[model samples]
Target: MIILKCQYLFNKILSKFFNIYTKLSFSQTGEDLIIQFIIGSLQLKKVTYLDVGTNHPFNMNNTFLMYLNGMNGVCVEPNPKLFNQIKRNRRRDKCLNVGVGINNEKTSTYYMMENSLLSTFSEEEANRMEKNGEAKILKSIPMELININDLIKFNFTTCPDVISLDAEGVDVEILNEFDFNTYRPKIFCIETISYSTNLTGVKSEEIINLMSKNGYKIFADTYVNTIFIEENLFN
Candidate 1:
């Protein structure tokens, strides 16, 4: 009777321990998994990020988990509403209410959509959405626009460790403006898909070529986002 009672007690303790462990564990997404791989491979406890097109502070955000882990950096979102939301939720991070592109324009017309994540600076994307009736315009805002490289120089004291780029349809333009030699992010989480969900409109090959020239290799591609890491870093 005593042995059976002890076994029951041990089982209860084991069950309680697992429950606690489960509560502490979080599965964010494929982005989080890739981020974890970078951190683990680099043996880094904290990292910095430049999150462009930060639609929501949490939902679909690649840097949200990093932020929770005491990592802070610039979050650029052109949408006023979403920017405000990011400001409220991410007090530790620097929030910018501006669009980033290849040229430093003083003001640019931002296409704000009902689902703010669908917002883009690309006229082609906006027109496509309108024609398909996929997304409705919430409003148009004349937002400040800066070159990606210039914005990084102005915001961060040093280059961010990781750059999470998700600029809807203009991601390539942003990359073109980025001076990879001057500011080489250890890891890049970029959305290669342009207008379609089926990867039909993705410029993945171009991005891969660009990164390959810079000595970075494709670390992982989760369909929606592709992760690249500097080849020298892993060694």
Candidate 2:
């Protein structure tokens, strides 16, 4: 019976792969490139993704591709307003109104701006803006903090296939707190907003070095985002 079950699952996976390969072959050039890279690099029919700071769940997310390919995962957003937006957009996946950082605690007084895109938890960046005389602040709800390990203890049966981080100014801090040796996700997609804000932004080289220390290699570096894959996984 165990062998029969394994054979059934193997046949199902082979069928799915053939279908996906056919669809991919006929897809548009740009879409085909992304699908091929993700499917080929990760070697999975369905992926588990974690989108940190998934504000508003815009249409441009790479996670959307996973969803289209019959994958499911969690979306974490700290801001209440933005979290609601994400919840509305990603009704199929688990959406959490929490922040990913070094610890699990309730934080208060997160800064909100009229332009929601500028909202962040970094008071230092807010203060720098005040110095530059362009400061705009509004009171907002606090986000519950949870580390990556905490998530593993909760819902994840296995490490996520991909983890995309877009936590505004705190991307570096979140990456630093990740124990890559333990939860080595297959791919990491991080936003690089260094040019947009006056925050103490991390340089591209700094990001490369941090990922390298954790046994990851840079796969792609677009102007707005950088992609990293586990070195051992790709080999």
Candidate 3:
């Protein structure tokens, strides 16, 4: 049964990539396009986003295509360079050069890594990655820390349609800080693992459980990211 399901999904994904990859591939693993396909099938329109840890405007960004598709939203990045890039490139979207979380203070140290994607605010995670030789810490810079919900409310006139989160090891922390009932993003594309792969890993179940309790269903798993859809949206 597992093999049959895998084969079915493989065929479906293959068909999707060949059909609309060019139009919908702003995300690293084509998550934007895959979500677009599902949203289209559901007859949904006017998609907006709250892109947390949006590293770049295009490279590995999950919300760039949404911006190009006439959807306006906010892009939050702790790195000043990347935030400026997003501001310059995606002029229509609100760009914030700050980290999203409930810090005790207004600012926190953001560890810049050799691989920019691995850069994070968690010192422990950074140290672990550096020890593992997975990443090298270049420097630590003070970044403004803002409450996630407050940022969303200030930027968005209405609730966001989607929320794509990729904040290194702090992804779950950011998710935990969000008021799920108030924001209630219809779709979520969240990085659930420290490593990237095509196969789902063990660490994702905790995130899945959290989202499940929030009335969301696991829609897809791209190993690095786990996509969730609000349960009520399908009704």
lDDT scores in order: 0.78, 0.67, 0.81
Instruction: State, as a TM-score between 0 and 1, how close model 2 is to the true structure.
Output: 0.76
lDDT of 3 by residue, 1-235 (tens): 2353355456557768766222436577888887777678787787778999899888788887666557788899988888888899888888899987664358889999988888999999899888877789999999888888898888888888888988888777777787988888889999887663345345667778899999999888777788899999778
Best by lDDT: 3
Cα distance off (Å), candidate 2, residue 14:
24
Question: Lowest summed-lDDT stretch of 10 residues in model 2?
Answer: 20-29
Q: Write the number of the candidate with greater TM-score, choosing between 1 and 3.
A: 3
lDDT against true structure, model 1: 0.78
Model 1 TM-score on a 0 to 1 scale = 0.85
Ranking by lDDT: 3, 1, 2
Candidate 1 vs 3: which has more lDDT: 3
Give the worst 10-residue stretch by lDDT in candidate 1: 20-29
Return the candidate ranking by TM-score, descending.
3, 1, 2
Question: Candidate 2's residue-wise lDDT over 178-221, tens digit each?
Answer: 87768888788877646345555555676778888889887776
Best candidate (score: TM-score): 3
